[model samples]
Target: MVIPTFETTFAVPMTCEACIKDIEGSLKQLNGIQKISANLKEQLVSIEGTAAPSAIVDAIQSTGRDAILRGSGKSNSAAVCILESHAPHVENKVRGLARMVQVAPNLTIVDLSIRGLSPGTYHATVRETGDISEGPESAGAIWEAFKAKEGTACRGVFGTVEVSKGGVGTVFLDRPIQIWEMIGRSIVVARQEDGKFDKNDPDTLVGVIARSAGVWENDKTVCSCSGKTVWQERQDEVGRGML
Candidate 1:
């Protein structure tokens, strides 16, 4: 099967040609990368590849710089889910984030990142309903269409994310699913025990997938509602353990 490649842009801090060279050099070491372009004046790096966005960000950060995704894929093809735990005892409920981009008609790439969870394997799935009033239990079962189409025992399963001892996990997955079908659906991430997730676990996180900006779709650095710059918003997210 041929994996489709798409363009993704990131806002990086670049002051001179050396900065671009460092980032470009780092990205070249990753697999599935086809092309790399960096604009020093704009402080943006555009990459054409099948690599996960999270992986690309990590690579750039390795050079002692932060990389924020500016846009990805085509118009209306990107989605985001901010996973938050409903556990009352947890101070910071925002434990994870999932970014989805439809690179092809039937293929979507998901960048899943989780933190502040027990060190263990966790499974993620898209539930039939987005209703999280009662948490994951109220999210309904896995979408039936996935089972029927993929012939998998459990439907809507994206895959597993193995949390490290530091309470962090990251996974990049490409599934034969469309981004539009996942919109308004709830994505659940739960601790896996004996290879199965316990629905009753209070630490389970759930979030509804919502459409995000595509390439060149969002350009404003300051938010109108919060009156915060993009960097400020990022710092706030980091403070809440969303990084």
Candidate 2:
């Protein structure tokens, strides 16, 4: 059986009942048998079950919001999460919320509390992309890949994992995303222009996969899960609304 835990921040503003209800519906359909609890006031969630926490997370994430898993321990009372985005306006916000709901409609999701966090602030949206124990033999390679990152710091989390490399210029979680490591090795290859090469440039492989996964600038991406590399289903609405 899998006992999952997390501590994360949501970037979106969570100051109303509608917001709570909105996220709650996102996690209800994840592929697992489970018991779950969410604390909106403190921004947390807790679950005990036979499924991987990442499964729950990827489901919650389809709602266009980031769900990061922080730390886990047996017998801890509270699980925490953070909101990571804010809408451009009222109608756009509504549509964004709807997209989140549409991403994972059947997981057992609960929207905990929203405190004094700023609106539109992007934070670490981590979740385990690993597995609890390889499910039935019928599951595919994607499941196999996700199940591999469990228990480590990457459990139930994906995307831009923060690395605390030592330096005065680096005290934050803005490092390269850990998901890129899932498939193969990442090389620091750079595209050059002018008389010098720019090392601070974004690479290509990540862009290729992200675009393939429906997250290109013009794509309406849902959960940027570690394995969602191909745009399997098309979304009706696609636009670059906000970051």
Give the per-residue lDDT digits (tens) of candidate 1, residues 1-243.
666999899988889998988898999999989999988777789999899888999999999998889898999899999999887777888999999999888888889999888888898888889998877878887776444654454447888999999988999888888888888999989864123344445568889999988988878778999999888888988899776
Off by over 4 Å in 2: 1-13, 75-243
What is the lDDT, from 0 to 100, of the residue 175 in candidate 1? 83
| Candidate 1: clashing pairs of residues | none
The residue-by-residue lDDT of candidate 2 on 30-57, one tens digit each, is 5443555565664545544433434555
- Model 1, residue 215: displacement in angstroms? 0.9
Name the best candidate (by TM-score): 1
